[model samples]
Every structure is written in C-alpha cells, then in structure tokens.
Target: MMLSTDNHAPLRRTPLYGLHVSLGGKMVPFAGYDMPVQYPAGVLKEHLHTRASAGLFDVSHMGQIALRPKSGRVEDAARALERLVPQDILAIAPGRQRYAQFTNADGGILDDLMVANFGDHLFLVVNAARKDADEAHLRAHLSGDCVIDSLADRALIALQGPKAESALAKLCAAAPSMTFMDAGPHEVAGLPCFVSRSGYTGEDGFEISVPAGDAERLAKTLLENPDVMPIGLGARDSLRLEAGLCLYGHDIDTTTTPVEAALEWSVQKSRRTGGMRPGGFPGAEKILAHFDHGASRRRVGLRAEGRAPVREGALLFADATVGEPIGKVTSGGFGPSLNAPVAMGYVPTSQSALGTKLFAEVRSQRLPLQVAAMPFVKNTYKR
Candidate 1:
C-alpha cells in the first residue's frame, strides 16, 4: 500500500490512464505512477463489489521478467533460479506457479514474488517497488547460460472476485480450465495474453498480462461485462488486508524473515534440510533453524473488540494500562467483507496463539484485541 511518488520525479501513467479518467477515477500519485485511488463508486463500494461480483484492476506497474536457458532446457533454468531463493523451483510442473521470497545472508526477506514454470522458461512477477533490486540480484547471481528478459512492453491487469472466471471464460474459452495457481498463454478478447488463475484478494480470479498497446482494449472489453467494475488502489489494499495478504514494505521487509512472517509454508518441504534438494539458497542455515526451533516472534491475526479500526504503527500491549509495548500493527483497517476491524502484526511467540488476549494503543486509547486466525474472510479460490 506504499504508493507515494518521489517528490522530485514526475509521475508516470499507465496505458489505461485515459480510461480511468473517463470513468471518473480519482487519480493520485502512487509508486511514481498517477493511479486511481477510487472510482465514482468510492473505495467501500469497490471493495464490496469485488467480493460480491467481479472487479478490474490496472496493475501495469508490476514488473514481469522471464528466465530462459540458452540450452533450451527447463531444468537448467530452474536449477539456476534455486540459487537465489529458498523455494523448490525445480519441482514446479509446467503451467504451475509457486509463491516464494528472496532472502538475504542474514535470514531476512528481500521480497516476496511469484514464480511460474512456463514450460521453456521461468516467469516471475516481482513487486513494483523492488523490481530494480530484484533484477540486479538475479543478474549478479545467476549463471551466464541463463538469460534475463524484462518484458517492458507488457501491461498487467487483474480481474478478481467470485464471477471472475465465468466472465473471463466468455472471452477466452480455455480460461476456466485453469485451477488455482495455474498459468498459461491464451488469446483473450482476440489479444495474446498470459493468464494466471491467481490474485491477492483471496478470490477466484486471473491476472492477465497483455501487450502494452492492447491493454486499453482488453480492459474495455472486460468492463463490458456487467459483473466487472473498475477497482482502484484503495480497494486493492483493503481487499488484500481482509484476505490477510502481506503488503511488501509494510508487513514484510528486509528485516523480517519468512518464518517470522508466518510464511514458512511458502518454503516447500523439498527445500528443507531433510528433503530431496536442501540448503542451497541464501540464509538456509539460520532460516532452517527457525523450523527446528521456533522464532522468537511470529505474525498473527488480531480482531479488535469494538468497531474502532486500528491503523498501522499502532502500539500493542499485553495489559490495558500498558506496562510495556509488545508489538506494532503492520497492516490494519476495516474489512468491508467482514464488517469489522481486522489487523495483522508480529507478537512474541508466547502471545501468538489463536485466541490470546491483547491490547492496542490507538490514538492514546487502549483497545482490547484478541489474537485470531487470519483471512478475516474465507478464501474462494478455484483450487
């Protein structure tokens, strides 16, 4: 949700900027691009619509890269990629995607990313903010035989919610065949597209990557569906938060390890010490130790007692009077789907259980909080 443009630089615009403006989208500078924060229907309605029906999001700012081996072997490229991250990349089948994180030497996360086995090459979708650093890391460590191709000519868009699959299948007949985390190339609306049955809103959806020149046409074609509406950054953040998804710089960073962020599931069993392929990526020792001995602090879900929504950086305490601070809220907000305030943050391992009682200091008042299970709402993925 960190979308502020640099003060000195000029703001950029996506290919669908004109369409957004024509739809009465309120443009705001975010991550160097002038993006829509909300449409005429506002953030709350957009958020609800995504859960009830479908929503279209212009995510062209995300970075897309492809790793191809000069020798034309998929295993060669997958093995080369395993050197940078602690994920079982070599085991991923063609047309399947895996969630992974780039770790540092000190067992901290550089960024969380999605890696897809696109048959002949590995496709990656990295964060818009950390794309430069991630690309630099890949180029610096990967073998010379592997080539890195940045797809600057592409534009990415996500169509999310319950009706997403049916709406999209009308245009691309093969889209509905893909299950969760499956990705493949198809012609959508008569345009070449790489469609992934995945999204951050905990819904059944697809993230479609199309040519930059054809982005507007693809978006307009999708919007013609009554189930689909344009959603903006404000709703994007709220939806992901309600789904308990981490917002890169805020929830997980270079200082936070995958174990501490409660993302150990992303580190596949094969990547661990006793599996088929083990201990090859950065910080494997320290990261693996957390699996043997639990981390000192762990991320957990928090549900506030009342309706007063707590925001990020709110101090957390064990007692209402606050003898000492225990943790801080990383992402917190009102979940339109749940009709309640939900938050996620790191707390001492002792207090990270499913129903531990806690307190959050918000605006100089202590609010009672209970450590609860995440995904404040249920995930409706097609898997």
Candidate 2:
C-alpha cells in the first residue's frame, strides 16, 4: 500500500528535488513528500502568476493506481468498477475520463478520484494524504476477476492556469485536440507523458503523469519558460476554493454523500435514471433516493463581504435564529480571482438557496454571510 504510515512525517523526495532546492523552494513535509511550500518569489506572486499566466505543481506523491482486467477482459473490469463507483464506467469513450468517489457500505465517499480510460487500461489519480488507505480500500473490494497495479514510480505534474495550453503547446500541440474530460498520451519536456485536460482549478489546465525518473527534467523544462512559475500548496488551496472544487478529507469525507457534496453531475443521468445501464452499485438505493428526495445539507458557496475570513470548523446559523448548528465551513480562503475572502461548506437545504442569509461565527463575532453560487469565479473550461 502506498499509504504506509511507517514515517508519519517521513520526507519522500520527488525527482524535482534538486531543481526545487536550486530555485530556493522552501521545502516542507506534506503527504510523505519533501514538498516545496513556496519559492523565493513568494506565495502571493505565485498565486497571482497562476491566475494570470501558468504554474507548474509537482504532485508525484499522489497515488497512481491501475485496475487491470480481473477476469482478463477490460470490459469485465470496467463492469466491476461500476460496483465501486456510481459512474457509467463502461460507457467511457477511449481517451476520456470521469470523476467519482469510492463509496463505503453506508453510501458515503471514501475518497474522491479521477478515473481515465486509455483504450488499453484504466488510470487513476487519488489524493496523496489518503493514497494508502484508498489503494487498500480499492484492492480489498475489487472482484477477484481483476488485479490492481500500483505505479509507485510514477510522477504527476499539473500545469494550470490561463496560459497552460500555450506553455504546453511548445511540447505537444496535439494536446489542443482533446476536449475537457479527455486525455491522451503525449510528450512534454522531452519525456514520455500522459496529458489530461482536467484539473481541480476551474481554469484550463493539464495533469501530466510521467515516469518518476523524468519528472525533474520535465519540471525544469517547463519552468524554463518565463510563463511558468512554481506554485505551492497555499496557492493550490486558494485556486481550488475559487473554483468551488471540493478538497477530500475537508469538503468531503465518508460521512458526506456525493449528492450532499453537490457532485451529482459526476453521476451521469443515464446511469442514475436507468437507460442502457442500470444502477446496482453499493448504496445505489440510498444515493438514488437523494436524487429524488434531494440532499438535506448541501455543499454551497458562501461569500462574506467582510475582510475577516471564516476558517474551517466554524458553525453556521440561519438568519438570527441560532438553531441546531446548521452546518460548518469545510474549506475557506482568500480568492485572488475574486479579490475577496470566499468560503464553502455544508448547510441545511432550507438555507442553501441563493441569497439565503446565514451567520458564521468567526473570532467570537457573528459574521453576517450569504450563500452565493459556486465557482466563486466563473470557469473557463476549454472545450
């Protein structure tokens, strides 16, 4: 299991170690990796650069898991995958991808992941913090008909922001042909790689999976471009927050159903409503019910005009009535794109409507807040 916790804060190094140190990257322990928290340029500059230009993130520490044909047939393996997630796995076209979560017996998300079909195999990228547990969970439940392979030596990098395409085009112009949710094999920084036109940030970007040995070379080559800067975890959180994207273990967890997480779009209508394929995966009965009855505490956006930013675990109340704590702030931060403090969390359906007035307790003050629409900033998904 990639999640071995032998060293709680053990520092694992990626191939880009030397380059990061050379560039004055302030390294820290994150998900078992000696990661670059920020560079000499500073976190604010890095965040602004990514919003205006492009930023490259070395995320090789995340899990790269493969579910091979258990019954020796890719279709059969895909069918088995349906038992784990609510997505129409078999319907995925070659080079296409889908986002889903591993559900526990009670129908709560274990870990959110992106599953990509490469015609010949299924590739996945999971959170680094939950990599070990996620891999074990997948392996334990996988039908004996398939086998799981771990790409332990793989390095993943994300080139994100507005100018990502142009920066990447220097290496593989063919990447432009792929639409959102599409992935294709391509080379960048003179190394073999896989490029996906999908990211947690709402801006256009690509997630590249490369061999561990070549990650450093690729990172250096991309950084050589004046347009590319090294972004840190701080910016990553702010970017995803502005995108209204959920961060597993924070915005979602085993207790939060996908429906409540407002990720129903990931569950294809055809799969849920029953067309060519039927829903028989675990907790389908309960999950489908949410589709019909609607989730009670829904994940929604909150925009507080005040300068004070609400942090996680803050209790939320509806209007002046402080009833049962309606919900709590999951992920909150300052959005560079919005130029204001933004927050997102779960709130009762009664108080989830747009413009619904709510109060967030921050620093002993009842901060007046309102539920705002998600994507705190508009998305620029390049079709």
lDDT winner:
1
What TM-score against the true fold does each predicted structure earn? 0.98, 0.94
| Per-residue lDDT of candidate 1, residues 1-383 (tens digit) | 78675788888788899999999999998887899999999999999999999999999988899999988998999998888899999989999999989999988899899999999999999988888889888889885869999888899999999999989999999888999999878899899889999998998899999999999999999999999999999999999998999999899998888899999889889888798988788888989998879899988899999999988999999999949999999999999988999999989999999999999998899999999997889999998
Clash pairs (backbone) in predicted model 2: 3-132, 70-145, 70-146, 71-145
lDDT of all the models against the reference?
Answer: 0.92, 0.83
By TM-score, who's the top model here?
Answer: 1
lDDT per residue (tens digit) for residues 1-383 in model 2: 12234565557788788888988889877767888888988877888898889999887878998878845566777787888888888888878888988887777888889888877678888988888997787788784856888888888999988899888998887677777889867777667788899887788889999998888888888888999999877787788888899988889888988899999988888668555665677777778888888878899999996878888888888755556668899989787777888999899887789998889988767798899998888888888
lDDT assessment of candidate 1? 0.92
Tell me how far the alpha carbon of residue 30 in candidate 1 is from the true structure, in angstroms, after superposition: 1.6
Evaluate model 1: give its TM-score.
Answer: 0.98
